[model samples]
Target chain A: AQSVTQLDSQVPVFEEAPVELRCNYSSSVSVYLFWYVQYPNQGLQLLLKYLSGSTLVKGINGFEAEFNKSQTSFHLRKPSVHISDTAEYFCAVSKGNTGFQKLVFGTGTRLLVSP
Target chain B: DAGITQSPRHKVTETGTPVTLRCHQTENHRYMYWYRQDPGHGLRLIHYSYGVKDTDKGEVSDGYSVSRSKTEDFLLTLESATSSQTSVYFCAINTAQGREETQYFGPGTRLLVL
Candidate 1:
């Protein structure tokens, strides 16, 4: 069975400071990794995704995630986060060839940005 | 911005009563999905539809049923609402334009069963 693990349930960071949300997955076959953000009272919005390409992938809002094959990790990072960046982050995984049939998700990490 | 909408953004129902949630998409995507979000479980799939009238169960489809009679609308129903079924439900569409399938979510519907 495939599963995703997000170690931290919540991460607090000072505004304008760098932030990193860690995610790891376990799967027998190749998989696609994705990061999503959900603001309060809103649905999830796609951050970035790793299909088949370079290990480093950049996304919206100056965010980036590095897909480490050997470590089985896809960590989301941002050089400087704003107050508006405060949201719950989720890590999801899907089977490589499956066309959105199943998308296993993590428990989610709440990013609290303080001024 | 896939133009997905879930009806009855908030609802309160009693146990043993039947409840149905509707998901409508303007994008006309081929694949639609229903998922529930709980405190510790994140988002778990309940059911999905591949096309009109082609539906299948998901990981957490024990007490839920779904129907898709058109490309734009997918409905999820609970035969008998339970307290455990009180959660936020989301609708998603598989809007894959390439090898990678990307899902766009709708503003969730919050259901509370007492």
Candidate 2:
């Protein structure tokens, strides 16, 4: 079985400051990782994904994450944040090399970028 | 944004009533999924369909029943609405030809069971 854990339930950051949302997963087999963002009243949008090569994956709105296999982690980062970036960010994983379509999601980290 | 539309964007239904939520896609994608979002729980998968008439249950499929009669349509029916079923329902599609494509989500349907 595959599972994901996002330690931070809520993160408060001032505008223009960098922030990181921590995520870790546990799986016995090869996996796929993903980040999704949900704005107020909107459905989730794919931020980025890690399928194979390149430990570092870049996503929309200047967001990026690194895949650390040894650590079993995929942490999302943004050098500078904007108030518009305030949203709930979710980290997820799928088992094996398929679409990882049947995803197991984390509890989520609400990034509150204050102006 | 992948030509996905979730009907009855908002609804208030009573207990014991049957409700069906419709998901229509214009992109002709082969996969469709239904998920419900609740406070602090993130999105829980209710059901998924890889093709017409081919459906599978997900982690939270106990109260949900789904059907896909055509390539462009997938429906989720709540046999009996309950307060616990009140949630924001989303429909997503996987369009990537090879891998599980990044899911493109519909606007979402807000159902309030009172």
Candidate 3:
């Protein structure tokens, strides 16, 4: 079985400041990791994903996440943030053997970009 | 969008009433899933279908029942509306075999059970 834990429930950052939203997962099998973003009253949009190979993966809106096997973490980061970036973020994973498509998600992290 | 559309956009109902939400898709990707979004819980899968008449339970499937009679339509029914079930519902589609399962979601249906 696979489960995810989002360390922070909320993160507030000033505009143009760097921010990181931490995520950790537990799974005995190989897994694919992903990050998604949701704006107010809107559906979720895929930010990025890590399938294989690289530990560092870049995503839309200048967002990125690093897949650290040792920490069992895939923390999302952005070097600089904008007020428009305020939204809810989710981290999800799917087992590799079963299929890299069916996802199990973390609770959530609410990003508040303040100017 | 992945050609996904959820019906009624927003609904308000009282407890004990039966309500059904419809999800329509034009993508024909084969995998359709129903998920609920809450304040703290990002998104929890209620049910998913691999193909017509093929369905499976997901993490939070107890109060929800799903059916897919055709490729383009998937339905989610709430037998008895409850305040606990009040949340935004999202329908997603994934072409797992080809696109590697990055799902595209619908706008969502906001149901308020009072």
- The clash count for each model shown is 0, 1, 0
lDDT of each: 0.94, 0.91, 0.90
Query: Residue-wise lDDT of candidate 2 within B4-114, one digit each (tens)?
Result: 999999999998899999999998888899999887888889999999899999899988999999999999999999999999999998868465467778999999999
Model 3 per-residue lDDT tens digits across residues A6-55: 98999999999999999999999888999999999899898999988899
Candidate 2 Cα errors over 4 Å, as ranges? A96-100, B97-100
Superposed by TM-score, candidate 2 places the C-alpha of residue A90 at a distance from the truth, in angstroms, of 0.7
Ten residues in sequence with the least summed lDDT for candidate 1 chain B: B95-104
Clashing pairs in 1: none
Model 2 clash pairs are A99-B100
Q: How large is the C-alpha RMSD of every model relative to the true structure? A: 1.0, 1.4, 1.7
Better of 1 and 2 by lDDT: 1
What is residue B35's positional error in candidate 1, in angstroms? Answer: 0.5
| Candidate 1 residue lDDT tens string, A44-103 | 999999988799999999999999999999999999999999999999999853454588
Q: How do the candidates rank by TM-score, highest first?
A: 1, 2, 3
TM-score of 3: 0.95
* Per-residue lDDT of candidate 2, residues A61-111 (tens digit): 999999999999999999999999999999988864444388788989999
Candidate 1 lDDT by residue in tens digits, B40-66: 899999999999999999999999999
